[model samples]
Target: MGLDSTPSRYRRIVEEHFTALYGSAFGRLGQVLAVDAAPDGRRAAVLGEIRSAWRDRPDAVLHLVDLDTGATTRLGDGGDVCPQWSPDGTRIAVATGGAARLVDPDTGAGTPAPPVPGVVEYLQWAPDGRQLLLGVHRPAATGGDAAPVVTGTGADEGARGLWIWDTATASVRQLTVTGAVWEASWCGADRIAAIVSDRPTENSWYTATLTLIEVAGGQRIGYRSDRQLALPTGAPDGSAVAFVECWCSDRGVVAGALKLLDPATGTVSDVDTRGVDVTDLRWPNSLWYAGIREPETAVGVVSGTGVDGDPARPAPASTEVAPAAGSRAGEEIWSGTDTIGQFYPAVAPLPGGRFVAVHSSYARPPELAVFDRAAEPRTVLAAGHDGEHRVRDRAGTLSYVDWSAPDGLRIGGFLARPAGTGPHPLVLHVHGGPVLAFRNRWQLGHPLIGLLVAHGYAVLSANPRGSTGRGREYVDRVVGDMGGADAGDLLAGVDAMIERGVTEPGRIGVTGHSYGGFMSCWLVGAHPGRFAAAVAASSVTDWYVQHFASEIGWFDVAFLGATPDTPGGPHFTRSPLSLAHRVRTPTLLFAGADDTGVPPVQSTEFATALAESGTPVEHVRYPNEGHVTRGQRAILDQHARTLDWFARHLPTG
Candidate 1:
């Protein structure tokens, strides 16, 4: 089958089909961040954007969607804000313009509530709705465009801390002075629990502690995990604080380990969650959670936990969810990987066991939906990005495909292939976080993924060793073995597909961002000639360079198990740049101008080495993009470039 891989044709398809649905590198996209169910469940307030965010504030618009009529109304605009519903649901608490306010959901009017020191992220409304607990991130040392994942610095001005805004007095006060606060929640009216670090750098968050800050005075360290902690939700009665703890390579993107702490008693225990890695949590009537159970993403309730279990005895404190043996927990009411109830699988608890989640599937665009524990979901507000369906249909079938690693471990991933496919050229797409996974969550909606599938190139997105959904042992295995078995697992996946008559040898291309980018470069370099072409975006081509340059240097130190200073370390051996001389595949490199996580130098260094090796290589940079390219034009350009690169190399039919 002959395919047209011209830049204009691919660019047009991306603009007309994808730019409208997901977003274009230029802008103009609606995103739903947080969903709050009204007291009556007739309406929900979504905290996000009705327009392009560009990762900048003043893009936040509080949208009120009537569940019955499916009508959406924007309350107002804000600089940087976290929107939360009052207990009574009469008003919404939001922080914008470096200040907090109470917004009338019906009238779209705002009541000022004094000013705070910084931009608000995670927040909570007091039980009585008279106060707001804000997770405020102060400005960076530069005092311009702060909060992105950048290198750690010593006690700079930029630090995330907690704040309390009293709506009654229209005043706000700082809660703590030391240690930057991240995910936070209010405990009753007098206490707050948060994930905090003594340092404000992105690397420090890897070891941040879960602390309980008292509104009365002192803060106490509640629980400190060797692994990362996040999504601390306070029980309504202020009895316990629940959080998801796990071995995470990246902050914000996490899964598994639902642990509860009774602050008064100072007793912390695991909420037996079978084996599922809880990604997000909500403490309503029951300790509800959304997480990944390998090939499936699920939302459920932890029944044996204090809330639903016998209050006479709290669950036993144990590291049951640790790197060893454990079973899945709670009642898995809903299971599937869609973009819903997310701060990454965010679930908004509605009244009477109903939940409203932002839904997106392999074929569906993002939209609001209501789901009961056992019943199928119904859309609340249509996302209006229906153009994706046609692309989905022609993009072929999406399924979870697993293959045995070279070492006998099973590696799972999502695969999309053309309809009439018999050993089609497979495009391996790697996810960013060695910690993140591809859960069939409308990834096909992505212009690049869809364009490839539409062009008869099967896509393989792996959840190989370091990915979540498989538990701590599985994820932590990548720590000292970043280039070892993890690389073999993905290469073995291509072999599995080959054995299954899915794709033949010498016809595959590889693409990824971040660690995936590292792997793409890793594969082409370490295991030469396995891939026909490679596109590494925001990549780490040289571990030695990455350790000194990347924002989270600890990531390299921790994952590689050796410092760059270590003589003859894997940092020197595993880096793609070390093997660049062996790369015969034409490689295309991409990076963001503003990225600090994996600096543009990471890409340029590899490009330089590849040029020295006489291997065809090109480096492309997005001016306004960051670690992840979210720009409309930038993304579109990436799609066109990726298709063009692969087309010139890989065999289609």
Candidate 2:
């Protein structure tokens, strides 16, 4: 049967795979992404999952998790994220596979309302809660699938437009026929604010001008902005919009100022808020934005007033902004110091102008704590599990440690020591995104790490040079260097892990997805004897071919620092094929057939090279997964096979 043909069988296969691979329940369950307060405020609209619910499943169904009783109700067939609670809070609007649906929160039943045939992303409920707005790429009838809007590529095969869908009537309208538009905010029932760019250039994030557009007339008035404006959040009064404006800075554009935009007057001023890039922004009476400036993570509150596109006066200075109660942006939030991992933090607004930040540590599961602003020295609502039995069955201490690279740059990583072991086999878990961070948050069904640990193996996840959370400089460290400094940092992390008594030196293995996959391939080739085995997933074997082959339009130039057509060529020295002769490790290569990001060719080319060199190698490809192996069953199976491969090659405790 096809992958999605039978959910029951798939779940069984995944469970069996998990048991065979992990041999322990480290409590690695699935994660919930979207949550909202119910109308009565007694319960919450939580869209999460149970691990076995859908094995080998690509996307998740919208499930309503009751806050009070922790009861869950599945909402739709599948393919959902970014669910929003209506203003009245009776219903919820969910952005699923390719459509927007309105579901009754109490019943968890939705009226099917599919979006136009295009990629619709970042959905928002209108102020009146009557309509939903989102960004979509509507391709021309003749054109094929929407090509990624890359940096230098001028081909606009799809028309990027603002789509407004009325939930009551299921009527949809194209607000703005602009391709470079991003992040729409509903000012009122008739007016909308969006970031638009006429002449788009390659930038890290969305770099566009804030524009106010009238839905009925298709009239557009550009809000004055010297730099790009993003994360546009409408005020409570629906009169003014507060957003972060990107300014050119010496230390890089990591810092941003809160600005009130006036569409009528075309005026934009720098408000009192000044800090790192705004990760999440919300307006609950006061304009609250979550900012992370590396060593210091703080939330700045701004207040202002304006309407009809008129500039407003700046708010008072933000004085007592602190970390999100239980959040540690630089250290605890991420799993390690050098590498970037995934983190799911709960930002729940509490009573009396406070917020409760709940998440888990690498060594622990989910935990909750309340943050009180009035208390002196900030009292802790809950210090979380006291490192007791919570981690007893866990492989090892999920400790955050740091090390210095050759250039004096501080690198971070997570060292998961084996449960009952002296010196265990070491496995380096390389992260994807190459730019994203790996934070210390709750993770469920982490097959690779959990299975390796259960098998008496020490796992190390490191954020080398290009990882985030440290600073903008650290994220862009591998921008121009790509494989150079990042590879060195990974190597250094392994060396440091061994010196720190985390694992044995001779029994080291490395594995990564996407960019991390490239590093794994590079590691096997660059330092031949350093690792006993390597697993490269959806990696980049040849940069020259990947510039046009990749799905993301801007990734090539943004990461490589040079376009494919540039004089010196595809920029950096990136070719797993060239280093194939040096790989002596028993290697395993993995990829998804449908991965548009790093296509299967990357894995195929490397596998071919290893086989041609007479090196021990194994290759496996999933039918429809994207860059990473994400289907519950697929991921479980991949994890089981990976652990088996590593165990057979690397020395076990």
Best by TM-score: 1
Q: What TM-score does prediction 2 earn?
A: 0.77
lDDT (Cα, tens digit) per residue for candidate 1, span 1-653 = 01133377566765665544544322332667678777667888777654442233226567788887878887766453567778777987766666667778889898876666677665678766778887787766553566554434444647788878777877788875468887888766688888888777788899899899888888889998777888888866677788888777778787868877878777777666666788778754456788778776677776544434322222332202111123325776778755564335777777666788888777776678898765788887766454556666776778888889988998998888887847899888888778877775665435577778888799998888988888878888887888788888998999999999999888888999898899999999887888899998999888877787776888888888888888989999888888888999999999999897887887888898889989999898878788987665576678777887888888584
Tens digits of per-residue lDDT, candidate 2, 39-79, equal: 34444554454343433453456766544454556776666
**At residue 27, what lDDT does model 2 achieve?**
32
Winning model by lDDT: 1
What's the C-alpha lDDT at position 489 in model 2?
84
